[model samples]
Target chain A: MEIQRLSIKSLTITILIVIAGFSVLLSFVSGEYFFKAARESQLYSLNRVIQVATKEIMQQLHDQAYDIATALSIEGEIPKEFVKAVKGETKGELVKALDDPLITGFVGAYIIDLVKVRAYDLKLNFIAESHQGIQGLSPQMPKILYQQGYGRKGVARSKAISGLWQHADKSYYSVLVPIGGIFISGYLEVVVNPVNNLVRLSEKMNSPISIRSGIDPKRFYYEPKKSTEKLLPIEYELKTDLGASAFLLTSYEDIAKLSEGVKETVFNTISVFIGLVLIVLLIAIWLFQLLLFKPVNLMLNEIRNITDGDISRDLQVKGLAEIAILSGEFNKMTKEIRSREEVLTRLSVIDALTKIANRRKFDEVLKNEYLLGCRSGKPLSILMIDIDYFKQFNDTYGHLAGDDCIKKVATALKRSVYRPTDLVARYGGEEFAIILPDTTKSGERVIAEKIMSEIARLNIPHSSSSVDDKITVSIGGYAVVPSIHDDPVFIVAEADKSLYQAKGAGRNQFVLRNEFNSVI
Target chain B: MKKNYLISFIVFLLLVVSGIARAEKPFAPEKLQGTIRVDAEAAAELIVNTPSLLVVDARKEVEYSKGHIQGSVSLLDTEMTLEKLSKHAPDKSTPILFYCNGERCLRSSRAAAKALEWDYKLIYWFRGGWNEWVDKGMPISR
Candidate 1:
């Protein structure tokens, strides 16, 4: 399309599409960037929360474990039987301690009173199965809890150990602290199940999460997609409190699930944002078409019509400044054009000097009247008038006076032809022609006599030539009722003959040609 | 040859000195007040008092997140604005400023100076911007 033909709607839509497309692409790219940023930030925050929570919970557990041990140690100091049980000589009390409801929710906590070489089994009795007796499984058997007997192992390992360990053939996080006493060498071990912590943390987050602990060498932790074997990275940290075990605070599955959910949220937000932009673009395009394109087309259409010469219609539009201005301009232009055309038409048909029909107009009227007369079988009449100028009029007066005289005589001739269909023309210099529709030869003669008398009364100077020079004019008249058989040129010839006769008769006279004979 | 070299050297030294002087001049009014480098906070305050101040928000859409100062309008850094300004900015004497992602950004500085060439006076700069306002716990109304 031509550049001018391009409408605002197309331009606006193009612009909006470009803007919206760029916005969408930006949202997609930057949304991903934002999602990654949010994920990183959330992970950092969640890690901190888990660390704090684990430390607080561990502190509470440590104090409780110490209290339980203190209670047992005091009881052992008084009761001989409790003292004997402490030496791996009795298993019932420790078993009773492991089964306590207070320790159920906690990562299993128990004390190995090292004063006795025999270990005390508590909190691990269910998972600890030995072919030997329950007394033998006091905490030393599996190498998962304590490698050697309680006394030897407790003394040999670091005084406080914080690291990952295993139980039930699965890896777990463990925190062990040695408690040196007046009589007994003892240590307290706290094992926290990371799985439970993961479950709790997941509940708080807007996205999904999972936790796992006590895995084997390659510990397979919580998985978001159970079918996927690939393990995404888990950001875990070992946490410790004064009284409780160092625990692993991490939710591998939760992190992955949260990332996925964040990605989805970013996608959804971007989609909605892009959708809103698209809607705005559509509205803009619609408004452009209504307010800009359609009105401009109307202006163009009106302009096209005016150029094609149909100036009758009005351009009707409103509500825009530029369009209103253009419409006003268009109306003004059409009005000017129509008025100018009227002036040109008048200039073409009227005589500038005499203010009467000129030769061109007379010829047009004669042809039209001749056609009408032929169709209606009505008579058509013609008169040819010549001024009886002595040439001496110009010789005596001046060309200006000659012109004045001619104008007066032409006016008289015009007054003589009175019918609506009659036309008088300045045929040439000092000569005039009259068309009389539906007039016969006698009628033509009467008109000629009237014109002759009117010119004679003007009494203009006619002193120096062969004719009486007081500005009289010779008149020739012819009339015929035209027929289908008549030739238009024949009428003019007959008028010419009568004019020759009047001129031949001595300058100032009238001659008429009837259908049968010529009369003068 | 020596005279020509001396002349060339003088021209070169003059060019260098002039360049350095241009660079050192306190961001010329032309560069200071255009849409490319507007001072957002001052522009916002000015807009509230006099709405004619051209307040261009140059923040990347994301940094705009911390929330824009009120009365700061967004003008894409790349969009041509000379024609728009001629039509819209009836008063040449009105103030104009721009702001982007706090102090770490360069978009606002360039935009501010671009508006200055059109003969706008009263150019102001808001260097410590979005981050500072948000960090201070000031209320972002929108």
Candidate 2:
């Protein structure tokens, strides 16, 4: 079965595909890792920046609220009114004093979006508030302040405490301060809008900022105005002095746009990398074709021609080391094969024992010559010679000596036919046949006589022969101007009959048969 | 022809016998004794549960500092000495577990063999060591 083969072109293509595929995969993996690391690092820095910005905003708001509370308590009648309202003495007058321009203007100065001011009694009951619709008392207000060591025995004794507080869906930064002079009478609370603070911080940092208030955990505020596809958000929890939770989510300035540049650079680099890889692959393929494939293909063609019985030309050996060596070896192999074929051709037709054309070669030559004679209307002749009493000779002196006698007779017969066109062959045991092209009956007779005389001249000793004291041969000759209808075998049979006649008359004689006459 | 066949048959028989002689016995856990052989899980348990069990990282110090089994002390295979062993683990009878990179590493085995030669009463060889430990998500220390 013939196996499927991969040609050099396809094999190189496959290898190139695998290498290119691996390069693309490697680049994709490394590119993803690089982008991921860049995003993470940007997010980390964004988180730190957001934390610092949030702290600064909270500090500024806390100081402003403290100033407002301290001014109302030290220079105004609001604290005394708060004490009267707490003792239940002239509550309407206390309410009227709380609404005076001095206190109202001071509270109005600090009031803005989502910011509110409230005054609470020592019992933690709410007294007056800048914003309307607030409840009379907020019991949940000062809990974080007390936990952060800001409230002592239900009085604000420490510095102003700032924290995050929630109402419905909105969050506020609340600062609590004591409002009394000598003894603590009430607690003052200032709530400021964290969304405005975060927006200001975002502008100051030149980045996008969003706030996720711990009070209102489900809502986001101060979101930037941009597409967030490439933005890496960094989140940091804001912890005030009172340990309140306010989350700040921010990202680098134009983070989405910045990452686009990174992606573009990476894509460009990968394209160039792939281009370089393809260029290298093409160069490598050209080099291989020049240095290996071209030479190998030429050698292959030469080997095929050698198999087809044409081994005349040697391959041109030129390439790299291995291919050059291969070409050289292939040329050497073809030379060896040609020499061996010549030796085999010679061995096939020559008689191993007699050193003359064997029977098979005689038949081939007779047929070919007969066909040629028919075309040219030329006379072709055959002389069938045999050693007389050869069986008796073999019986008297063993087969080995009989073979030596036959070799001598065959050599004599070969010498008798001197024409270049004539052929002498060992027909069978003790019998020889000669093909004589363009020869007449008279010419055949002369050759027949010469062969008989030549073998008799050898004078090989034959002890048990009645023919002669020396070995001799009988010759029978047949000649014809062969027609297309005539078979060469008929002439061969006629020669054999004449050979029998010559032996019947006497050994060491010649006989001839032509178309019109027969002679002895 | 018959002699040729007889010679060929004798050659084939010799080939078969030689092939059988070259065959090895299958691994049996019972063949490994005199040293307690533990896997990564058992070694991690010994390090965590036994405070006195000296968990030794049998690799170079550079590799040890990169990452190793938690609470393991670096003791390289090439640096194994009686003095160094006594300095870290003075009590000869104290249980000691040695581990290296992984199953393909021979450092831990060599260190364990050396500890045995030192006449230590308890020596544990963690065959599947740091590689298996990290793969299994066990604790690691640098």
Candidate 3:
């Protein structure tokens, strides 16, 4: 019954595990949603930042182009000797003016004198127009008497003229204006550097972030099993009206990686917490068993063993209210039983008249020995012994003296065979039997003869002239390996036959039955 | 060495202040100064500054010896008569502080509730009692 109360422990463990499982599941679901929302917000914010910065860059380019146009329009004071050397050529004067501070250190700037274009470097060097500079430029730049965009292909292709070549990387812008009544067209360029922009943007974002200047559709990375076709490619365009087009490509993998870190951390922390909870719970359960359940069971077991007939041992338990109570109850119960058994055992399996094992005890012990012999495949021998002329002896000596004589012979019969396994019983009036387990036929005969002789040695006189001059016994013994099919009654009948034969031949002797074939 | 010294000083201060202001109500001494080593002392100092107060003593007859503050009464031997105190200590809102012998003393603290049962509000316990009061000689009367 106390064991039934232990269901509470299992119930508590189940409830805790269920709570933990649900919490982990909820955390995973919420974490997934959080990762999705954070990644999208990060991307949107990065795009906005790039758009704003690029707009500023475009505005600066447009302003520089206007200044170059203004510079080309002005006429510098050329000395007569300088004019003679320049031959009044606009190209020479424009090239000489390229060293001006306005043109120097600028990202993209170009000056055109009639047909020729000169671009200024950060070092203030003026270089003649190369083939590439003449072709590529910002598409937003205005055309002036130049057939560049006038051909009307794609507007971007026609307006593009790359002229301002710097740092071995060319990024160009185009401008057209009138210089001294002559239409001059110039192309300015810059090389787009997204690395610095991306680094700075990442710092501002204060999270994992990236930016790419040129878009390539192939740059997307995805895992096949987790990615579906529904997850479309991310594409955004960067357009400066000056005919520059830069595609923006970003990977969702970066977001995925960040989410993985979070997932791993969360799972690791949960696993550790779960492990700790399990360990603590295990210790609690063990303590409950040790201090509570185990001691209680021990008291119960001691009680069980005492009730089962071992009354010597007592229960010893300490600690815990319930267990202590149980221990006390058990000790009291076993003590009562031991004292009661002291009285009851004397009356158990003992004949009041003969002081030998009674018929009931013989039946119980015979069945037990027979069952044991059947199980163990051992031979058991039984002897059915009857005193000859017992009725006449009772008639002469009176019932009391006859009862006394039977008891005297029964005592002698019991004392003759003294093995612990041997059992002697007063089967009925004047009929006593001995059950010898693990004995062969010859061994049974030898024991039966000894018991017969010991009874004769008691030397009680019998005047009845049927078998012998003195009181005597006729013993019949049968030995067999007991089995399921063999009846104990059949063995007793066979021994009884031998007993009749002994009485017919002469009393005070034992008759042995030879081995017979088993019916089983 | 400086760090260890600072730590030791802090521990010492905490122990000393812990001995005093062991009361629930603010402990406003007749005169007050110095930093508190314990949070409870600081809390008591904050509330006990005003006048018009009731102080209950729950110490035994032998313990009431040595010293006790003026205007304080021993309620330990008195039968539970919360209803009779309405006339002598009329204001239910007046601050009250209760104190007994030492750390093991729960008697005075329990007695403080008698005033509360009578609906005398603002009850407190001075956990330190006479031993701490004599250590710091602010003000005293037999």
Candidate 4:
């Protein structure tokens, strides 16, 4: 491609724009992604809080039930009677033992949320409960435990086999424990209202909580029907040994905190994105300027200078390797152009055939001599020489011979002028002019006569010549000391008039003229 | 290159550890052998009166942890070795009681039988096991 086709300035701008676009896109996409992630993670953590709280509440119930069971087992009277009952003793005594005020009172003192303490037989059949004669819960065992086995939980496992049984709006946390320790006469079901402890659960969490029937809504706003304060709801399931979702423990988290956290997260994400983008943009621009744009612009200016005819200076740029190389190449190109121009200048001042100065150089030197003569009050002279009957010689001999004869005559005329300050030029075809600086009138005549003798000595045959059977030339000379108002062309005109007179006298002759002399 | 070495070293350590573990264990019998199998109440009476009796729970640790009799140290029948048995009851004549999940489970029987082969004396096999213990509502702890 041409050098100007891919301008570095335009390329830099394009690359900068592309980088900016990519950075903006990255920032925007990441901002969106992080915003969603922040919100989702916060909501997820709230759900986690709900899960841990429910587990803790369930764990507390199990621990309390286990402690109560251990206490009852330690009470000798209760276990002793239970053992007898398990050994197939009559149920009347066991009923009496369970209904006793002392036994019931002892259980009541252990827990505050205690709903009831009921006993199940080996077949998990309901027997006698506390003397309060509470009318609740079916007399039959929970079918899940009964159908699985005859209270195998009382023997097989020891985690206080529990289930959450919801009756109306009141949900009870019930634990099934083997009451008589190792012998396990029957299972004791301790039913406690988990809602009362939930008050503490809410207080412990520093949030409000509500128990729904089933855990379906995991992420939702708290019931607007309950309170006016804006709140986010986090929910968890309280599962039972029956492996059923018993209740939804929904904790109302103040939206103010969640929103503040989300806002901070989102703000930080966007700020970081913007910061990264800005840093990237700055770095990219700096690199472009340092490595590409600055150097290219410098090169362009240098090239402009070259185009404006100032090819002397070289392009030097300190930058990236490629840009340095490009500048070096540009400098090399300018050097080539300067050298070629020098060659063209030299060729323009030279005559092609004679290997001497041409007419243009002659006039230029004559004018300069005239000016110098005017300044120094010195004399300047010009000689106009011509070959006599050179056309007849060309008709007789051939054009090649004519050219050879002209070359010889011009060489003789040039050799006769030995002054370093003199200039011999091929004024036109077969005509020559010599410019002499600091030459007086006699000196001019001497140089014109010497040129005639040099041509004669060459002895070049010219049978068609009217003067002699050899090549010869007519010489005309003029000398003048130029003044400030004098034109160099006056010297040229005087020399031409004298040359016409000499050619009129006959060929192979010389004539000299000067403004101060009578030969003019 | 560093990662490769770490992985190889881990694999080598695993191989060496497993090799030593395999080499260290003694053979245990799979089937039940001769032992005096007592009921749960009788076993409880023996344990209550005899402070010298060592109660061995012959169930997997997970099953045992669900709840075993109080003061019973757990060792699965499948994992039993002569060294392990001796560690529990150093005196061959010491009264050693073994129990597992009740009659449906064979861990106690196999353990008791393994003990008999090891020439241990006074091995009481509580065949009714933890099932009968809890079923009878006998005194128990976690």
Candidate 5:
């Protein structure tokens, strides 16, 4: 099975995506933490404001209760009337005394909501209540009032006592004032409902406030209007003048809304952040393509052209510093390759010992020229030359001298050919051949005579010759107007045969044969 | 050898001075057992309501006369002998409240501890003491 590999482009994109994903996740987590912190701080401030407002309202209620208690206790006329009403044992008279204009007028002078007022005897038995419904005192009232130091003895000592009291369905803030001059009589109690004050408190604090009766859980008062969402049910047990235990429950939803706002801001910030990240990534990819990938691709194509034997042009230098340096280095490398290739090409065709075209080059040129001559109907000629008694010359002067003599002969023969189109090649050891592209039989004879004269002019010494005392060469020549049916090798064979004839006759002469087999 | 002796003498003098400084540091109160701790507000409330409550200023007579909570009587911790307490509070069941300068002062806690040892029925230790009372702007007497 083959596994697909990731390309650089795809890999870069994948890494960018991973980084973006991680950043988004980080933003989400931080946003959540920020929301939580903002929510907590909002709640804390809300709680503080509610506490201050509640304390102020409670203090106002306490002052009102104190004022009422002080007014009733210090007034000698009210205490005397209350004593008469109790002694007369007339319910109608006691009710009238309790609701007299002086007492009601004095109570009404304080503008706070005085829900109910009642009078109790020293034994804490019910005497008279201002509200319509008559009620007997709670059996636990005496014990609670005594424990709070607001009992009959407490009133005698402290002059007055105010406290909160809760029944089955109602809670009240009541002040107990002892009705006596020096000896204690019945008690005059003034009760006020705290719900109205709580309402004002709710408005001041901008949050919902309520009171729950600790003595009777069913009794709830001053509950704020209904809300969509409630938060932080802060319950504080109040230590007030009342004997009844009560608790205040307050909730603030604005803090929750503030947290929602924080979340919204966080989401918006994250969105903008992600958008910027994407833009940056795109720009980065574009820059990579422009500065690196494109330059690298151009360099790759240049290398391909070089391998394909088209190393004529150099690479263009451009782009960023590193890529430009790489391009320069690549160009230098291709130039070196081309120079080495030229040297190798030259070395492959030239004869190493004689500094002339070798046999292999000769064969390639002969084939190409023959084909050309056949098509053009041009007369092509070949000359074959041999060093006379070259082996005997070697046995006498040694092979080194023989080699020196051969070099001299090769040079002389090369000098004999005048036209640039003619070629001279070292045919073999002690042998040479020349190809002339456009020459007749007479022209071939002329070149062969010139080669013989040039070789004779060299005047090299050869000691062991059966013909002359110096080195000499035998030459053979052939010329023909090539036809399509003729082979180029046939010209070389004819020239070789002529060279055999020249060697057979003597050592120092030339022979030539024309296309029609006539000797010249 | 004389130079070595001189160095040793200097080292000994430094050690003695540091020891004296450590020993002269003021005493801090530790946790007290078998007592209920109250703040200035609760103590003031109790003093006002409970007639039998004895507010003992557990400092020296000079420190107590400088400033103290209203209705509180001076009763130094050093002078809180059994005979002295019995003379002031004939009934051992009377509520006794103790206080000093502040939390760092050990006099109030020590007096409360002595009262506990004497088997007083009710004991209240106002840890915030005279400093908190003045800070709260509560009524005080000199």
Candidate 6:
């Protein structure tokens, strides 16, 4: 048994959905990789921002320290003791002057935020200094004077050396400025606190922050914790200039938001893609109905009609080429079946020996003609013919020769009737009949005489015949305008009686009569 | 017109009465653990004497810019974070002095205690703050 196939529409939808599902899966995997790339880029940019901010804060510190140092150098220009102290002409003169309340007043009045100021001589000797730089730090020649950046080349070009120096347990920048104008007699060191600038650096970070400096709990800094699940903490160690542990900078960035956004974007895109695929699926099924299924269904209906016995139905092929071809082939098959049926019908009503209408055909034609005569009130005629002595002819010439003579008599008798309305049949062995519609009494007699002459014309030898040594027939015919009261059997019976009368008179003769009182 | 004026006068009287009724002190509490309370004169001395002293104005930016200690750094108390406090005073032993709008503002008191809580040892809160400093005609930056 053949398994029922899935419908074309169902098959189309299934194929389309499978393709869409595969595409969605492929894109989802690719999207995951794309999200990974995006996360990596974000982390890269975040690291860059950290480096840039650190550099900015350090630069700002140098700039502030540089500004203070330049001011101190200019203010100290008025004091002749600075010049004297720089040339080694006076060892403590600049110190003494800077220590005076009046000189302190003048300088403090000039620079408001000045915390510490140190003046050095040409030979890098501690010449004079103010007291307010870093707490517990005494005035001394900066050891950085001998450092690489501040050595002979620096002194020659008058370049400044700068950095955050840890003095008195405090970190601050000390900037050096030349005391004299272009001649460079000495250098001034101005201290700038880095605490304020460093504290404000938290503003550069986008997330909540914490910074732990060394092992000291006091130096450990952080924002209050709000959520542990959403905020993922991360830390990177910042090494100091001396290569020791500087601080552990920690932060909790809300990375879930980014991942969630990526997921939502992927979901929305997949949904739209599926939606589009579904629309295409619907369109495909409809197109199959229009361009394929409908035409095939039409052909199926025509075949169904043919199965129900409407063999004359011709199909109108339509739609796609394959279905049209199928319909065309079906029409050809039906035409062949109809022609075969016609041939079978013809064979059933024909005689084997005579090749003419058999007894059954003669009876059917007689009944039809009688009914037509009843309606039209016209004369209907029939002639029954018998061989004079066919049994003797068969004994003399053998059955095959007798059958040949009967076939010849059947053909000649058929030729005697001209109209298509007439029917000639072999009623039985060695017997024949003819039906003529719309014939008068005289018309019946004329047809009977014509059939006798036509049969005699064959001239087949019959040595056993009582009348002559040639094949011959005696005919009996009757004509009448029949009515509803008369049966076609009565007409056939009357014609048989007439055949008996002719046979009784003698062989090779006919008696023709009409039941109607009206003559020809 | 006379009746309207009378009603206006009555409303004004009610406002005055309410103002007097709600004249509560704006000063922060006098005592606090983990901190040393000092005056403006002591604060000034700490600035000049201590080499490692960090003066902080624990007030809003607007208040600090109006008039604050000359060497003080503005670290707003309301906006203070441990990272910010530690960045200013990384060493626990560093002497950090805090001040705000005199006795009327509690920002300095809170900020000074917050510093000590972060393990800083020397947390000084100047109770007199800017008011006493101005009254004494001490040096001003602006």
Q: How accurate is candidate 1 locally (lDDT)?
A: 0.60
| Candidate 1 C-alpha lDDT tens digits along A252-343 | 43456677888889989998998898898888777877888888887788778767867777778663798999898878877887788888
Worst 10 residues of 2 chain A by lDDT: A150-159
Give the Cα RMSD of candidate 2. Answer: 25.2
- What DockQ score does model 6 reach against the true complex? 0.01
lDDT of 6 by residue, A1-520 (tens): 3336776656666777788778778877877887888777767766666667666766776655665455445444423678876555864656565444334543332322345667776656667776434455656644454363344532242445555444443344566766643235677666655545554456766666666654452675554345545675555555444444555566556778887887788778777877787787778778887988778778778889889999999998588888878888888898899899888878778998888999998888888888888899988888898988999988988888988888899899888999999999999998888898998768888888888788778888888888987888999888878888989999888888888888998979988767842322
Error of 5 at A127 (Å): 22
Kindly list the per-residue Cα lDDT of model 3 for residues A1-520, writing each as its tens digit: 4767765547656666676677667666766776677668766765676556544544454444544443333233212212332344454544344333233333343322222244422122222232222345333333222333344321121122322222213223345332221111222222223332333332343333334433342442212334433332333355333434443433222345665776777677667766766677677667877787667667667778777878888888885887788788878877888888876775688888888888888878888888898999999888899988899998988898898889898899888887998988898999998899999887886787788778778988888646777788888888878888877777677777878877887777777774483211
User: Fraction of native Cα contacts kept in each candidate?
Assistant: 0.00, 0.00, 0.00, 0.15, 0.00, 0.00
Q: Please, what are the lDDT tens digits per residue for candidate 2 over residues B1-142?
A: 9999999999999999887765532222322356898876577556645779998899899998766765678999889898999988999999999888876677888788889889999998887778877665343444
| CAPRI-style class, candidate 6 | incorrect
What are the DockQ scores of the candidates, in order? 0.01, 0.01, 0.00, 0.11, 0.02, 0.01
- Name model 3 segments beyond 4 Å from true: A1-313, A319-332, A339-346, A375-377, A517-520, B1-142
The candidate scoring highest on TM-score is 4
Off by over 4 Å in 5: A1-4, A25-34, A55-196, A213-219, A225-246, A252-263, A284-340, A416-420, A439-459, A517-520, B1-142
lDDT of 1 at A516: 62
TM-score of 6: 0.55
Model 3 agreement with the true structure over B1-142: per-residue lDDT tens digits? 9999999999999987876656543433421121111222322342334346565567775666544654566667255365545544677777666666644565654566566566665766665665655443212333
Predictions: Cα RMSD each: 29.5, 25.2, 32.1, 9.1, 13.4, 19.6
Candidate 4, residue A449: Cα displacement in angstroms equals: 5.4
iRMS, all models = 29.1, 25.1, 45.2, 7.1, 10.1, 15.1
lDDT value, residue A360 of candidate 5: 90
Return the clash pairs for model 5, or none. Answer: A162-A241, A163-A241, A163-A242, A164-A242
User: Which residues of candidate 6, in runs, are more than 4 Å off?
Assistant: A1-209, A212-219, A222-278, A291-301, A392-403, A459-466, A516-520, B1-142
